[model samples]
Target: MIRLMFLLPILLCLGWYYFLRVNGVPLKQGKRGFIYILAFSTLVLGFFVLMMHLTNPG
Candidate 1:
């Protein structure tokens, strides 16, 4: 789980970049694209962590 937490961000970011490229979103030419990916990945990680904290049964 600890390792997964670290890997999830990279996977999420790459997946987002790929999604954008598939739709022809000019990632290399715009700073905003990178920022959007970073923000999206962070939000997903935050939500994952929050859910883990809330659902711990121990």
Candidate 2:
């Protein structure tokens, strides 16, 4: 369960990259895309952690 939390963002970013590549998006050409991915992944991870903490505060 904990491992999945970390892996989920990586998989998401890979999928996002593939989607962008397939659609011929040029945003990945600059740091903007990388920053977006990082921000998105961080949000996802933080959300998961927050939920887990809220549910299992021990």
Candidate 3:
């Protein structure tokens, strides 16, 4: 479970990267790309935080 908490976000990001490439999104060259990267980063960070909170005792 602990390992999964770290792996899940990486897997999800890879999937998302594949999806973007399949659609030919310019991942390296524009404002749109930056937005997508920013959003995904935020999502991954939030997921990790949530997992940590769930696994830790107060």
Candidate 4:
């Protein structure tokens, strides 16, 4: 689970990169796309952390 949390963002970013490249976006545009992916990944990771915190039966 811990590993997955880290890996998910990387895979998502790679997919985003490929998608942009396939659509003929330039490297500059791809950089911007990466920034967007990073921001979105951060939000997703934060949500997962919050959910984990809420559900832990400590």
| Model 4 whole-model lDDT (C-alpha atoms) | 0.82
Q: Model 4 segments beyond 4 Å from truth?
A: none
What tens-digit string does per-residue lDDT give for candidate 4 at 1-58?
Answer: 7658778768878898788779988878678778877888789889888998999999
- The Cα local distance difference test for each model comes to 0.74, 0.76, 0.67, 0.82
Candidate 1 lDDT over residue span 6-37, tens digit each: 77667767776788789887767655756876
Instruction: State residue 40's C-alpha deviation in candidate 1, in Å.
Output: 0.2
TM-score for candidate 2, residues paired by index = 0.58
Number of the predicted model whose lDDT against the real structure is largest: 4
lDDT of 3 by residue, 1-58 (tens): 5446556556666776787788887656444644666677678778878988998988
lDDT per residue, candidate 2, 3-27, as tens digits? 7777766776777778778888865
Better of 1 and 2 by TM-score: 2
Q: Residue 28: error of model 4 in Å?
A: 1.2
Give the residue spans of candidate 1 off by over 4 A: 8-28
lDDT of 2 at 3: 75
Candidate 1 steric clashes: 0
Q: Cα lDDT for residue 50, model 2?
A: 88
Question: Which candidate, 1 or 2, has the higher lDDT?
Answer: 2
Give per-model TM-scores.
Answer: 0.56, 0.58, 0.49, 0.70
Error of 4 at 56 (Å): 1.7
Looking at candidate 4, the ten consecutive residues that score lowest on lDDT are 1-10
